[model samples]
Target chain A: MDLSFVIFVEVLYGVASLVLISAGLAVVFGMMKVINLAHGEFMMMGGYATITAVGYGVNVFVAMLIIAPLVVGLIGLVVERLVIRHLYGRLIDTMLATWGLSLVFIGLATMIFGNTTTGISTPIPGFAFGGYQVNGYNFFIIIVSILLVITMYAILRGTRAGLIARGTMQHSDMASALGYSSDRIYMMTFFCGSALSGLAGAVLAPLVGLVPTSGGAYIAKAFITVIAGGPSLIAGLVSSATSFGLVSQFFTFTISPVIGEVALLIAAVILLRTMPKGITGRFFKGKL
Target chain B: MSRRASQDVTITLVVSAFLIWFLPLMISTYTLTVLVIYGMLGLSLGLIWGFGGILCFGQAAFFGLGAYTYAITAINIGESTLPMILAVLVPAVFAALLGAMMFYGRLTDVYLGVITLVVTLILFKFMNSTAGPQYAIGNARLGGFNGIPGFQTLNVPGDPSAYIWGDTYFYVCALALVIVFLLVTWLLRSSFGRIAVGIRENEVRMGLMGYNVAARKTMLFAIGAAIAGLAGALFANWGEIVTPNLFSLGQSAEIIIWCIVGGLGTRFGPIVGAAGLAYLKFMLGQQSMIDNTLIMGLILVLFVLFLPRGLVPAIETLLNSIIGHKKRKPKPHRMRRARHG
Candidate 1:
C-alpha cells in the first residue's frame, strides 16, 4: 500500500475510535449527571478481562463479546453504589471522590497485575481486509462500536426507559415527583455508560497494549470530547469526535501528536468558552 | 484572637518548630532530608489550597518544572544560586500565565482542577516522549527519560561547602522552611489574603462588591506556584537529579492527598499532613513488607468519609472540649425579636 493510503487508513481508524468513545460519553452524560473520571478505568478493566479470558484458552472473539462489558459493567455498578451515588449534584465532591476512587482502582490494578503492559492475542488470526491492511481484531472493534452506537440510538430514542432517563437528566427532583424513580434511572445510566466504556476497552485491547496507567492517557481526551461535543446532544458528540479525530490525526501525521493534542485542547477550551451550550444549542435551543 | 487561642497557637508553633529542628540530629541524614522535602511540599500545598481554596492537583508540575529549570539553567549559567532563582522564577511565571488564562476564562473549582491536571499530564507526556527536538541549555541536553544530572549544588552564604554531605545543609533547609512559612503566614493575613478568602467563600458576592475575583485567584495561584517552584529548586539540589516523574499525575495526586490528609483551609495542616504521611511512607519503605500506596489509599478514603474537616480542626475541637470552655451560643429568638421590632 502507498504511504498516503496508509495514513488515510490510520486516520479512519482514529476517527472511528473517537466516535465510539465520544458517543459512549454523550450517552452517559445525557442520562446521568456524573462526570465519571474513572470511565477510562472501566475501559482498562474490560481490556484486562479480555486479556485474562484469552489466557484462559477462551475463543478470543467470544470472550471479548461476553467478558469485557460484563466485568466492566459490574465494576461500574459497584462503584456507583459505593462511591458515585453519594456524589450526585455536588460537583467538587464528585470530582474529588471520583479522583480518590481512581487512585484506589489504579493502585489495586498495579498490585494485582504488576506494572507491566499486558497483551491480548488477536481474535481473527490472520484475517485482513483490502489494501488498507486492517487487523481483524481492530476491524471487529470498529464494527462492534458501530453496532453499539446504532443500538444505543434506537434504545434512547424509541424506549420508555429512555424517556424516563432523559427526564431524569432534565430535572432529577421533577422526574421523581412525576413518579419516575431518578435513582433507578441513574443506576441504569451508570451501568450502561460503564458497560460501553468496558466494551470499548475490550474491543481495543487487541489493538493497544494494556498498562496499569493507560487509563490516565485517554481521560483528558474523553473530557475534551464531552465538552466540545456538548453534553446534551448525541449527534453533536458524533460530529465533534469525528472532527477532532480527523484533526488530531492529520496534525499527528504532518507534525506531532503532542502538538496535535495541545492544539485540540486549546481549540476545545476556546470553543467551550465561546459557546458554553455547544453547537446543538444553536439549533435545538428551544427543545433541549 | 482570644487569649487562649493565641496561647494555643504559640505553643503549637514553638513545639512543632522545636521538634523539626531536633529531628535531624536524632535521625539519619536520609531521613532528615526526606522530612525537609516533605516540609517544603507541605508549604507549597498550604499556600495554594489552604489560603486560595484552589484544590490544585498539579503542584508537582510546577515542582518538576522548577527542578528541570534549575538543573538546566544551572548547567548553562555555571552557578548554582542564580540557576535556582531562575528555576523558581520560570515555573512561577508559567504558572501565573496559566492561572490568568484559566481564571480569566471563568473556569472555577472543578473546571480549574481539570485544566491544571490536563496541563500537567501534557507536560508529563511531552517530557516522556523524547522523540522531538531536545531542549538544550548550553551543552546540557534534557535527556528526557534519563533526566538531567550532575547539576550545580546549593551555594551556602558564608563558607565554601561541598554539595550533598552535611547537617549544615539540612539546617539551611530548616531556615528556608521557617522563612517560607512566615512569608506565607504574613501573606495570608494581608488584604490580598482576605480578598482570596472572600473569593473562596462567595466569589459572586466578591465580584459584585467590586473585587476582581479572577485577578485575586490568579495572584494567589501564582504565589502558590512560586512556593512550589522554590520547593522544586531545593528538591533538585537535594536529590541531585531531575526527572519527568515530577510532572506525573501520581506526583500531583500525592500532593493533593497530602493537602486533604493534613486538613484543608488550615495553616499548619499541610505541614502536619506532608510530614506525617512522608514519615509513614518512609517507615513502610524501610520495612519493605507492605504496599505503602495501598495503605495510603485506605487512609485517604477513611479521611474523606469520616474526617472530612481533616486533622487540624478535629484536634482543635478536641483541645477546646478538653479545656472545659463553654462554647458561645447565639442569643435565641434574635431573628424573631428583630422581626417583631
Candidate 2:
C-alpha cells in the first residue's frame, strides 16, 4: 500500500514536471506555430538566471518565479523582433535559424557558467512517507504544476488578453482587421512562452544539475510532449503530459530510466503514428 | 535531357576532374580526404532538404549508423569490403524503415524533423550508456562514449594484403566522391528525381496526379541516407574511430549548417558549403577570438534573413544579372523542370 502511494506521487511528479518542461513550448509552438528550436536554451538561461539571482541573495521562489522568467522572456522578446518576426510562416527556415541560435546560446552559457555541471542543493529536503523518503521538492513541483495549470487556464480562458492572443494565433489577418496589432500580440505571446520556459527551467534546476548542454535533453522531450499534445493548448498539454508521464514513470519504476526514456520516445512515435494530427486534434476538436 | 542541363552536368564532371588532379598538389592528402567526405555528407543533405524539401534534422543518425556498422563489421569480419557495404546498407535500410513510418503516417514537416531528431537522441543516449561488456556485438565492443576504435580500415577490395592509405586513399576517396556526385546528378535528371521534386513542390498536387508520394519520399530519404552513410564510412576510415558523438545533435546540426551555408538546390552548392565552411571552422579553431557557436549563429541568421538563396544560388543570380542574358540559369522552378521534365 505504501509502495503504491509513493509510486502514485512519483507518477504525479513526472507528469507535473513534463507539463512544466513543455508548457512554454506549448505556448510557442502550439499556438504561435514558431518552432523555437532554441527553447531548451531559453530554459537553460532561465536556470542560470535563477541560480544567479539566488547567489545575489534573492529568495529562491522569487528568483525562479520572477527574475528567471523576466530575463528569459526579455531574451525571447529580442529573439522575436530579430529572428522569429521574419520567419513566422516559414516553418523549416525557423527550425534551421533557431537551431543556430540554440548553438549560440549554448556557447554563451558555456562561456559564462563554464562547461562543468553546476547546481544548488535542493531547498526542500527529503521527508519520510511510510518506508520511503520522498524529496519534498517533488511535492513542491506537483503544487507548482497544479498552480501553473490553474493559472494557464485562467489566463487563457478567462482573460481578454488571452482571447486576443488566441484570436491572433488562429487568424492574425482577422485579428489585424479587428484593429489589433498582430506584431505586438506575437511579441507578447512569445514573451509569455519564453517566461514559462524559464520558469520551468528555474524550478527544475535544483533537481538536475545544470550544464551548458542540459537544454538539449529537454528539447526533445518538450518537443515530443508539445507535438504529441496536438492543438488544444492546455487540454492537449495536460492530457499528453499525464499519459506520457504515467507511461514513462511506470516504465522507469518497473525497469530502468534508460528504458523509461526509450519508452517515452516509442510512445511518442506511436502516438504520432495513430493520431497524425495529435491527440487533441482528434479528440478535443475546439476546446482550448 | 535538355542541352543546357547536359551542359551543366558536363561542367560538374569537368570541375570534379580538375579537382581530382589539382587538389593533390594544393592540399595535404589528409585534409583533402576529410573535405571530400564532408562534402559527400553535405551533398546528401542538400538533396533531401534542398531539393526534396524534407528537412531531416537528425541526418547524423544515419551517418553514425554507417560508421558504427562499418567499424563493427570490419572488426568482426577482418575484411574491409563487407564492412563498406554494411556501412551504406545499414543506414539505407534504417532510413527506409524510418522514412516509411514517417511518410506513410502522413507526418507534417515539423513532426518529421522532431521525430527524426528524437531518434538520433535515442541512439546517442542509448550508445552513451552502453559502457558495459554486454554491449559488444560479436568481437567488436561498442566502447560506449569512448567509441569503437582499432577496426580494420578501408582497403582495396578482395586484397587483404595491400591497404589503401595516404595519397592512394585520397585519390580513391576523391574518385568515389566524384562518382557519387555524378550518380546524384544523373539521379536528379532521371524520371524518379522529377517526381520527387514535383512532390516537394506540392505534395497534394502530386498525390492527385497519381504518384505514390509517400513511397517516392521514402526512397529519396533512403538514397540521402545511403549518401550520408557513405560519408560516415569514409569518416570512420579517415578518423579510425566511431564514437557516439557521431549521432550527437551537434554533428547533425553541423551537417544542416553545411547544406544551408553552401547553398541549397544546386549540385555544387553543398560542396562549396562543406569545403569552405570546414576550412573556415578549422581556421577559426586555431585562434578562436569569438565563440564559434556565436559565429555560426550569426551566419545562419544572416543567411536566412538576408541571403535566403545561399552563396551558390546568390552568386548565380548575380551572374545572371551582370553578364548572362542568354545563360539559361538555374532558377528553382526551372531547375525543377530541368531535372525531370
Candidate that scores best on TM-score: 2
**How do the residues B165-283 of candidate 1 rate in per-residue lDDT, one tens digit apiece?**
46766776776777787677667666887787767766789999999988888888888888788888888878888888889877887787777788777777887788788888878
Which ranges of candidate 1 are over 4 A from the true structure? A1-5, A22-28, A125-137, A272-288, B1-13, B131-134, B157-165, B286-290, B326-341
Tens digits of per-residue lDDT for model 2, B1-341: 48967897789779888988887788788988998999999999999877787889889999999999999999999989999998999999999999999999988687787789889988998899888999999999998899998999987789876788888888888888888988888888899988888887788999999999999999999999999999999999999999999999988988888888878888788888888888777777877457777787778778878876789978877878898678665454443211110
DockQ for every model, please: 0.35, 0.51
Candidate 2 DockQ, CA atoms = 0.51
How many times do residue backbones clash in model 1?
A: 0
Checking candidate 1 for backbone clashes, the offending pairs are none
Deviation (Å) of B210 in candidate 2:
1.8
lDDT of 1: 0.73
Best candidate (score: DockQ):
2
TM-score of each: 0.90, 0.96
Alpha-carbon local distance difference test for all models? 0.73, 0.88
